[model samples]
Target: MRTEETPLGRKRRARKINRVLAETYPYAVAELDFRNPFELLVATVLSAQTTDVRVNAITPALFAAYPDPLAMSQAAPEALQELIRSTGFFRAKANSLLALSTRIVDEYDGVVPGRLEDLVTLAGVGRKTANVVLGNAFGVPGITVDTHFIRLARRFGWTNETDPVKIEHAVGELFEPSDWTMLSHRVVFHGRRICLARKPACGACPLTTLCPAYGEGETDAAKAAKLLKYELAPGREELLKKMRAGATRAELRTEGYGLQA
Candidate 1:
């Protein structure tokens, strides 16, 4: 457990950490593929306990079959179940998706609601899901307290709380509301790429000096570099090399990695 520091000291550390993360992950955005708000909402709901890669793979066919709330709300249960089978929790997810679409079609006139309250009221939608939809789709600012955010927030000394709501409120107080959405992306990006749950790449972390939990992982450069997530292997290294050479995020995207973890 970390000793509580002065509030002002903690804020300073958090600000520096935020800045470093922004620089490191300039192109951090939602990794899930979506053409619009409705697609994003469904994709996010299916993403529970699964990876973005898997969700992405399934969504193309899923969306093609039922492209809108009206269409999706009427989809056959068995068909929907089989369609999303590989995403895990298929039956529950299908039920939620069907119910969610039905509610949108019935209540919101076939459009995904923009407000956080209304979004959360939809089936399978929670605070985290609502925040993701609001921030990415509707331009509303919100903090998404995912597992990555929870872990990194404590490691960075921003908040000691374990509850997602408490962690969201605590960190929300430190940054501007507009920064909340992107802050989530950067922190999640760092968490996935460097500050992994089991073993972090401490020596290779750009924010090591600012991090309170600095020595928790391998400190040797070679070993630390090897600790990066599998997806970040050759691509992340190449991306970093270009970033050092002053590549814009758009340029990096052209070179392949513009998605968030």
Candidate 2:
């Protein structure tokens, strides 16, 4: 994927790679389980330095205790810490959630702001976090440049920029705004399940020919199969078959899928 080409040619190839990913993971989403904007805002903040599984495990309790900005704004620091202890950096995260909740209650009238500009103003919310909230919660198109997105974008020759904002702008130029949110989901899903940072399952990946960094990990199909995670893991065929049969992501979530958490 990292090859010499005209700017237009590179953009064309990038869209093609996105198409392959779209096919590979038809059930792609943010992975975090949140019912509304406030939950998503808090979850995305807690998601830093942790996996979605850990965050999801704790959100239910956290939300049960403090379901909204007004409620969370008054949460006891010690209680919040205990609830989110598994996500790591609990103290810092607790402070963030408390501060942001207070701010939302005071400033936004207990409603999570849907605009990116307003979202970024909250404590612990950056472009990535704001984008997640804007895209998923508000139906606003945004490119979330998380670690997985940055690595895969560079490897796919989509952009040479290292900064998240630069990468977002560069990649955003390649696809329509309508494609931004879904494209982010697809790229992150591929990175999590196949194009792993340390041991990518390149052989099992659909974008092998489109990936410039192919063969950086095990390229043998059988060996690569062991490297897959989540829905692509061994013995997960039924999930894949169901997805192929037009199962909605919500339907899979209801059936006790691992990602439901």
| Tens digit of per-residue lDDT, candidate 1, span 145-231 | 999999999988898899999999999989889899999999988899899999889989998778889999888988898888734
Tens digits of per-residue lDDT for model 2 on 72-110? Answer: 999889999999999999999999999999999999999
Q: Candidate 1: where is the Cα deviation over 4 Å?
A: 1-4, 234-236, 239-261
Give the range of the ten consecutive residues with the poorest summed lDDT in model 1.
230-239
Tell me each candidate's TM-score: 0.90, 0.94
What are the lDDT scores of the predictions, listed in order? Answer: 0.88, 0.90
Task: Report the lDDT of model 2 for residue 97.
Answer: 96
TM-score winner among the candidates?
2
Q: RMSD per prediction, one decimal? A: 3.2, 2.0
The number of the candidate with the highest lDDT is 2
* The 10-residue segment with the lowest total lDDT in model 2: 252-261
Name the lDDT value of residue 48 in candidate 1: 96
Candidate 2: misplaced stretches above 4 Å? 243-261
